[model samples]
Target: MEVKDNVVIITGASSGIGLATAKLFAKNKSKVVLVARSKEKLDKLAVTLPNSLAIVCDMTNPHQIKKMIKKVLSNFGKIDVLINNAGQGYNSLLEEIELPKLRHIFDLDFVGPILAMQEVIPQMRKQGQGAIVNLSSGTTRMYLPGMSPYSSIKTALNVASHTSRLELAEDNIRVSLVYPYMTATDFEKNTLKSPRLSQSASENKDFGDLPPVDSPEKVAKMILKAVKTGKPEVFANPYLEKGELQV
Candidate 1:
């Protein structure tokens, strides 16, 4: 779909891919709504973007997700796109996984996006056409040690995204998934790391052989491509083809 003048809600808009996406959409003339728990950052970003709104929200909360959608609709009168980008990373070996932390990541990386999708569907349906771009990770295909919890949650989101695409096809709603390889971002710094896992990850030889890291701006362009082309999946890794994973 054409992004120009479209009302687009982007979760995790305070940083990384979401931040780049918000800026890119704003540049393209889309009405951008920045959503994140970082109130100051969102507010600051909103002010810099033309026709943008900042909504401080914790994506893990269903009520907050619902309220965010309502506010978007109230201000825009219609929803054109929903970008489910708010998520966190967790790292732990299977035996070392913390249940509470696992559950929190699950809520952030999987459940929250699904809830956001549920909240926006009615408005998208009312408009008779909309696009949803879900941010997934290339690590889902890497199957790296200490990444099971995080990758598994993203894998589940992959399933939801593709299934939603098929289910929403008749309604003229498009659901797309953007898979970003390791990008230069604060994700690593923010990730929940286990002591043992961190030490092991530091020694993992495989990481040293991986391709060059992608930038957030490159991933942001792939997201824009996903929405514009309505492709089921878009990859930020140049080494990857549509269905194949190189790393």
Candidate 2:
């Protein structure tokens, strides 16, 4: 689909990849709707971008997600794209992971994006075309010792996104997944660490060997490419040699 002048709503737009995506879409002349919990950051970004609106929203709340979609419809008339980028990181051993923290991460990483898709699908169906991109992690395909819980949640989203691609095909709503390797972002700083693990240990924990870290702008471009081509999958760093890295 053509991105110029299209209405695009991106959740978690306050910082990192979401923020970069919002700016890139704006630069391409799309009407960007920036969604996040940070009012100051969203407001600051909205004014700087042409034809942009910022809505403070907590993706974890179904009510808030619904309201955000409604607000986007109210302002833009039709929804062209929905980017599910709002999520948290969790790292803990299976035995050391706390139940409540695990539940919170599940809510943010899986449930929230699914709910947002539910709220946007009807509008996209009415319009007869749309694109949805869900941000996933490269770690999902790796067997990281302390990352199982987080990767499991992303794996669930991967399944849902792929399933939606098939189901929404009839509606002309394209659903895609973008896998990003380690990127320069505050993701690590905001990650929920296990109580049993010290701060330094969690920070210093290595993932064996990995590829070069990607930047937020690099992933943002892949996201834009996914929407423009309606490809089912896009990878930030394809050197992992995975067969799924096509497009």
Candidate 3:
């Protein structure tokens, strides 16, 4: 899909991968709509990007999501791309994790993306072509002792993205997923601090040395390449490789 002149909405755009992608899109001349819970940061970022609109939204809230979509359509007239990047993680064993927190992670990592897709599908169908890019963790391919909740939800998201790709094929709407290998984002810090995670994480603190990770800006470039080349997914890492994949 062409990035230029496209109406793109990126959730979690206040920072990290979302923010990096927003900057790239804006530079490419796409009408970028930045969504996040931080109004101050979004407003500040929007000022630097041409044709950018910032919508402060909690992806977990249905009402706020609907309003965000309405606002985007009212401003841009059409939605060409929806990037589902707003998500949080919990660092605890499944048995040790609280039930409510697990559900909340599911709501943000799984449900919110699907809800946003639901809202945009009608418009995409009317347009006859569009794209949905979902951010999923590369950790799903491996394993982590204290990352069951996060990895499981991301696994589910990867499946949903694949299925959506098949279901939306005839409509010319592409569904793509980005599996980011341990990027140097605030994810680890936030996950460790998450209240839903067990206190054991804070007490024991066996985090060890941080692994070398990709920068958000580099991953953002990979994502844009995936969208522009009609690639179904991106395995973003230092290697920065691509392949035709379906699962």
Candidate 4:
């Protein structure tokens, strides 16, 4: 689980938690392949990090994901870590959703990660030891009214990670998940802004401020700690404080 010299592939690496994690990995001298649709951000990050591969990959597309995985493994020889950080979210009531947009969230949040996992697990198994860290949400633990689609899908992801860990454990592949509250990221401000969620969310704007959210860079450090330590999960909040966790 040592970070140094490991080849790690991180989806959604153009920004937010993914970007932060990429930088952290690079700082620790891990060769990192940064994946996302934005070539611009990826290129900039690569310029600053030695042994960083920035591939403009759209994870939702099966073919692109396969190509990206192949390219990374070819360049790095083995995939030591795969961090499933790319995802989408919806903010709306169940009744007011359009078919495609409704499905797109699950496609991005659930299906895309699974597809990426399917591609990488074999390589990880070959290595005889690897880790898959999934990025989930605190919304599944806490809640907000218009986040039904988001929270449900996020919950499903963690469940899948748990089951996946049990199945992959025999091969020495570790599956870990991270559940973080709202962190300051371009992700929220530039959300798909699904119209279906908007109409309902506007009326029920029940989003009262809770605890202060952390910066993505800070959250990413916690994720790296989990990666190095093989922790089952990391919660980016004081709520998982001293007295709250079960020993």
Note the clash tally of each candidate: 0, 0, 0, 0
| lDDT score, candidate 2, position 196 | 61
Question: How much does candidate 4 score in TM-score?
Answer: 0.91
Order of all candidates by TM-score, from best down to worst? 1, 2, 4, 3
RMSD (Å) of each candidate, 1 decimal: 2.0, 2.8, 3.7, 3.4
Q: Write down the lDDT of every candidate, Cα atoms only.
A: 0.90, 0.90, 0.86, 0.83
Least accurate 10 contiguous residues by lDDT in model 1? 238-247
Of 1 and 3, which scores higher on lDDT? 1
**What would the per-residue lDDT of candidate 4 be over residues 1-247, giving only the tens digit for each residue?**
9989999998999989899999999999999999999999899999999999999888778888889999997888899999999877777666655677768888888988999999999988988899899999887775555667788888899899999999998998989988776788876655555565554533355547557668988888888977887788888876533323222
Candidate 2 per-residue C-alpha lDDT over 32-91 given as tens digits, one digit per residue, 9 for 90 to 100: 999999999999999999999999999888898889898998888999999999988988
* Alpha carbon deviation, residue 61, candidate 1 (Å): 0.4
Global lDDT of model 4 = 0.83
Off by over 4 Å in 1: 200-206, 242-247
**In model 4, where do residues sit more than 4 Å from their true spots?**
193-209, 240-247
Which 10-residue window of candidate 2 scores lowest in summed lDDT? 238-247
Instruction: Estimate the TM-score for candidate 2.
Output: 0.94
Model 3 over residues 1-247: C-alpha lDDT tens digits?
9989999999999989999999999999999999999999999999999999999999998889999999999998999999999988877765677778888888889999999999999999999999999998876876766788888899899899999899999999999988887677787667733444545554355547644668999889978987887678788863324322224
RMSD of 4: 3.4
Ranking by lDDT: 1, 2, 3, 4
Using all chains and alpha carbons, the TM-scores for the candidates as numbered come to 0.95, 0.94, 0.90, 0.91
Tell me which residue pairs clash in candidate 2: none
lDDT of 2: 0.90
